[model samples]
Target: MINDGLTDSKFDQRDGIPDAQKMSRAPTVAIIDIGSNSIKLLVARSSPNNSGIEVLYTHTIETRISSGISQAHPRLSAQAIEAGTRTVTELLRLARAYQPDAVRIVATSAVRDARNGQEFTELIETQTHYRVDILDGPEEARLIARGLATDPELSTLNDYLQIDLGGGSLEVILLQKAQIQQAISLQLGAVRLSEQFLLDREAPIDQNTASAIQTHVRKTLETSIDGSLPSLPVVATGGAIVITRAILAAEDGLTIENRSACMTMQEISQLRQRIGGVPLHDRLAIPALPPARADILPTALLTIEAVLEVANADQLTHSFHNLRYGIAAELLEKR
Candidate 1:
């Protein structure tokens, strides 16, 4: 019995359960990630061969927690809270249909920073039979590192660092020989940086503002990492990188077969200047980038550039695997 919008007895009745997906020996689970920019759902099951989970379904809702944000008090707007919670409920409904053995919901920076973030999560739990796990920046970084290591190429990089740029924070992790040596989480994120420096206004971002943004990012990275970094390959993850990878892949007449993309430092530098200099609306024309991400793309790219400098990397590689994958893999392993 339940008192909220959903009852325990009717958990899997909203949509007929997809028992077919569970027929496989691999145990199925739904990985739901609620971030500052989007609510991502990955319905998957562990592969019997222990290779990787097979994705049964995927969905993303542009909840955009950074929208209508108040930097002064660090509070998410009522609209943002409502939109995020509603999206969570909807995704839970979809997850239930898959008859997954587990439904895991994790919240990132936006929820972790908000004044009433826990209240919002409680609201979702009251209405739906789902719990949103709030991950700290450092833990988030470790999970992202694990997820990146899932990629065959990323695992082979003995001295590689992976960075995930989300709307709320940036996670930098250093891995050596497939083991995470060090990981740090920085406050610099696409949405927060945009709100404070880059795209706070509707007009095109000016050159001075852009320079200031870069200076700040540079200083932050310089102070965060103490020693001189080795010139190793860097890997990127998150929404902005995903979009950037797709765009770069299209330009090179290449296809994303392995769910990863690579670009040289020269290419990334050129992209930061060429695309970051454009006005807001023009950003919509970029391949695979939706309007929801246009305003923050410039800042996201700048942050990536900063991370590369910190790592002393000359090239960037991006993988589609991220936090959601890491969470799913962890649960499946435990199961």
Candidate 2:
């Protein structure tokens, strides 16, 4: 069984490696991740001769699954189902062109929470010839941990806490020397929080509103986890937080390579405050700020801030590599 409570997976690999582990060359693989806020495709080729995997291509679309999630029930709206299926169909077509040895599609929180999620996945499979694997909470956490572990520098920590902030949920995993000690997925997502408390209002939410959001997040984390966050190296991933790192780098006039550099809470908070004041329309003009992310950025940052308090770390390092990277690595090992 996997950490996210999944017993098994029906995924298949491309034709390069043998069960005996005697392979001359690594296989080329593709993964399509249907996330809450976005759909991403990552194509990579691994070489047994070489220790690293080469990323052939990556693409993403802001499908915004949260928008389609019916607040009243665990169902996706008609529009959402259409958009999600369409995106996956297009991605499948593209992945086929690459002729990867194997291609797999996985859906996360948005799909897992939807009452009609199975219907949506079935539609995509019928239309695109791809099975959609829905990752439960613990499974998602474990895969992320495996992916982040790809970084040699990060894998060496005496203790490491990975907090992946997705559009529909937050997966927090605590690792002791690269082994998972505890993991949990929380429903504290930017899209959900914005819909619940911050939207239908003007830009630059007042401190009062921020306080309420913070209180809600903090109390929720405390209740979910057994105790305070362990003192350890803190790492963050997911689209919004990763992009925020790049945005911060741009604001500081730093080079592109340094965008993923470590950042303190103050820097995060300052960026949050800066964007909070700018209306969505004006935010589009800001460099490195994606138009799709402008409205939800404030709440996204707020969630990170609250998570940082639990981490109790002075700074947070955002990994550009996400779950897709981890999934690929796991497949390579099986090969």
Quote the lDDT for 204 in model 2. 66
- Candidate 1 C-alpha lDDT tens digits along 270-291: 7767677777777778776688
The deviation in Å at residue 259 for candidate 2 is: 2.7
**TM-score for all models, in order of appearance:** 0.88, 0.89
Point out the worst 10-residue segment of candidate 2 by lDDT: 1-10
The sequence of per-residue lDDT tens digits that candidate 2 reaches over residues 112-187 is: 9898899998888777656678999999999888878666556556578889998788899988866899999998
**What does the lDDT read for residue 171 in candidate 1?**
83
| Poorest lDDT segment (10 consecutive residues) of candidate 1 | 1-10
Off by over 4 Å in 2: 1-25, 47-52, 68-72, 199-202
What is the C-alpha local distance difference test score of each model? 0.75, 0.78
Prediction 1 global C-alpha lDDT: 0.75
TM-score attained by model 1:
0.88
TM-score, predicted candidate 2 vs. hidden true structure? 0.89
**CA deviation > 4 Å runs, candidate 1:** 1-24, 68-72, 252-260
CA lDDT for candidate 2: 0.78
Best by lDDT: 2
